[model samples]
Target: MKLSAETLADLHPEISRPAYDRSKVTAGILHVGLGNFHRAHQAIYIDDLLARGGSEEWGILGAGVMPADAQMRDGLKAQDCLYTVLEQDASGDKGRVIGSMTDFAPVSPNHEGILRAMASPSIRIVSLTVTEGGYFVSAETGGFNPDHPAIQADIANPGKPGTIFGAIVEGLRARREAGMVPFTVMSCDNVPHNGEVTRAAVLGIARGQDASLADWIDDKVAFPNGMVDRITPATTEARINHLREAFGLEDARPVFCEPFRQWVLEDKFTDGRPALEEVGVQFVPDVTPYEHMKIRILNGGHAMIAYPGALLGLTYAHDAMAHPLVRGFLEKVETTEVIPIVPPVPDTSLTAYFELIEERFANPRVEDTLSRLCLDGSNRQPKFIVPSAADCLKAGRSIDGLALASALWCRYCFGEGEHHEEIPPNDPSWDRLKEASRVARDNPAAWLQMSDIYGDVGQSPLFREGFTKALNALWENGTEATLQAYLND
Candidate 1:
């Protein structure tokens, strides 16, 4: 049967459903992006909290500013904002219906509904999981890009704002005018120092509209930095069908993820928040250590494998992990280069953390895609991989494996996979990256000159020489042989 509020009672007794009464739950959080990751991760936590017989006021009102979000709204509405989360592991699969999300606003051009939802006094927290690139950070300065076209448009027309930040600013303005307290603007994206980046974007947009309002927001509002980790792959038709076959349930927007999930949040909210610590969330004074550890080892490990995996035409992440060369390259690079620069995280050993990451990547049932990991290199490489490389360079550490990873990125951008299949447009700067890759085939320095990506690290003689050798090896010897050289060295 189709899963909905009405069908909750009829589902298989084995399938987990909400223990708390969904009817009594009220909206206290307005989450901006209703993507699979947020659904499988944050919503699940809230669901767990409510099931424990409390936090009834902390239900989620899902909102989206982007045009693509309209489809999500439709899907969620069809299911009565109740969807399935299929957690897969070596043991088996378990299914649960998440009831934390009460409703989703219709995606609109002006985003009037979303603004009103955010401005509501009852909504104390405005959380977001928009991807890393959605923050409008400058590649050159690594700060808010005030000159971005969307920001410019929002500045000119403040009342009818077009971007997410614009909507947020307008919402905050309405609350201020209504004499209501501002909501905490928490960013749940994968970027390092996500709360700070969120604060910069919101303040930058607010400053363009009214300096006084920006000051008020800066003084009153809270943006808590957080680190969220979950391997929730994009849902496929087969996955949806699997829900039907496995549990006799039909869910339009089911989420399939690995069994593991984590959220480390800085404990700073303006009004109040759900007692998330009651669940598995770690409330910390500082999320930096945890953030650095996960971003460097787990996220960086993904970067280490993604390009070469895609070039070699591996489909699933576990398939790449199973390959001897790919596994060896990841082990060598992370241990020798990336982990050495990572600062110590409390209650965690970097070596054990890497082992956990390897185990997660090798989860066969999760089926995380190599192409998904390989997407948006322009944004991800900076956040995930390049900072480690830059730190290694600054510390005068060997960057041989790191350089090879960068070279693989450049080669992957050549609009062809290892089997010469046509690589779709994966990056925002595809043309430039492709041209640079073509040029660097002859002179390796050509790719590094794209300072927006490589920055001064490319100019380092050690990095340059290592990158040159890696690029040449990739071209002359192929990915497997190149990986062997890095491994054997």
Candidate 2:
């Protein structure tokens, strides 16, 4: 089957497709980043909600903000905005064709179409999955960078926007002028307090233009902080071919993820929202406890293994987890240092949650790439790993493992692994990082002195001392031996 609305009925009998009429599904949400995570997580949830009936009006209207997003727009548009989502784990595989997205607006030169779509009264939610760097946040200040080129361009020509936040502000401005209720801005990224992060970015852009408009937005808009979880790997050619050969299905942008999924959101919306509660989306009063727990355990765990895995030339996350030294470092750091400060979830056990993360990381079938985990270290380190180190330092707790993790990141930027093999560029700030790593090879303090990444926390003597020792060990010895030394110490 070609996996279009027309050929969907001809798909394998076991494959699940949409049961409701696609025509009836209206645009109630306009998502900015139409990436694999959004497709696998939120789109799936909305798809499930629609299948249960009475939510046809809440369908998603996908929008692509970046120039690179045109590829996704074309791929989904070719198939009537339909795509396959394959979930794999030890338990089994479940393939579903998600039809939650009705269409994707073209990534215009000036983003006119996107602005119009955002201003639509039907769209009650304007969501985002633009990565941590996409928000134009400075790691040093922990705030929006007003000097970001894209934001500046958007502000200069307020009528025609450049970035997602620009488009969002324009959309909100238009809505306000039309006497309409503003849509809620939802952020589904892995960043801590993602909703607040998004709110700050949007407000940062809006306030730059007009202080009164910023005040109105500050009063009217609802940015709900939420916790989202799902391990979705990039869709490779091999996986795409497997979909075609195994299920007689062919799609351009199919998504692959672990069977496990979770979404805990704050029950705050400016406009009327869907009954996602009926389909297992937890709508709670607070999402901080859940957010911190996941950030420290799941995301922090990924960071703990990523650099070491890359340094060892490991290809997949599961393979990294299978290595005794690699898994030992992760387990030791997560348990002794990381998990100690994790806030209590309502009824969820932290130990059990960590166990689940371990299982997900080690799922061989998922084959989540170590490179994917290792990407964007400069932006990711401040968000994922540094928090644990800062918390441990603040609480006067042991931070050896956390320091080792940071050292591994700096060494990984040295652009080589064991046997001196070439490690490809990973972070957006790779050149600056590699330059610092080379300098720090002789004087390890140079790496920590990166005020942009480490900020004030990098100034702490405790972390500085530990990071220096780890970086030196990694240079003289190898990753495996250095990890062993840490464990033995």
Worst 10 residues of 1 by lDDT: 450-459
lDDT of 1 by residue, 1-489 (tens): 998999998988778999899999999999999999999999999999999987899999999977789988898899889999999988889888999998997789889888878877889999999898999987667788899998999988988999888889999999999999999999999999999999999999999999999999999999999999999998988888888888899888899999999999999999988999999999999999999999989988998888898888888899999999999999999999999999999989899989999999999999999889988998988888888899998898888988999999999998886667988888888898898888999999998887777777878899899999999999898898899888887
- Model 1: lDDT of residue 59: 96
Local distance difference test scores for all models: 0.91, 0.90
Candidate 2 residues lying further than 4 Å off, grouped into runs, are: none
Q: After superposition, how far is residue 433 of candidate 1 from its true place, in Å?
A: 1.9
Supply every candidate's count of residue pairs whose N, Cα or C atoms clash at under 3 angstroms.
0, 0
Q: How many backbone clashes does candidate 2 have?
A: 0
Deviation from truth (RMSD, Å), model 1: 1.1
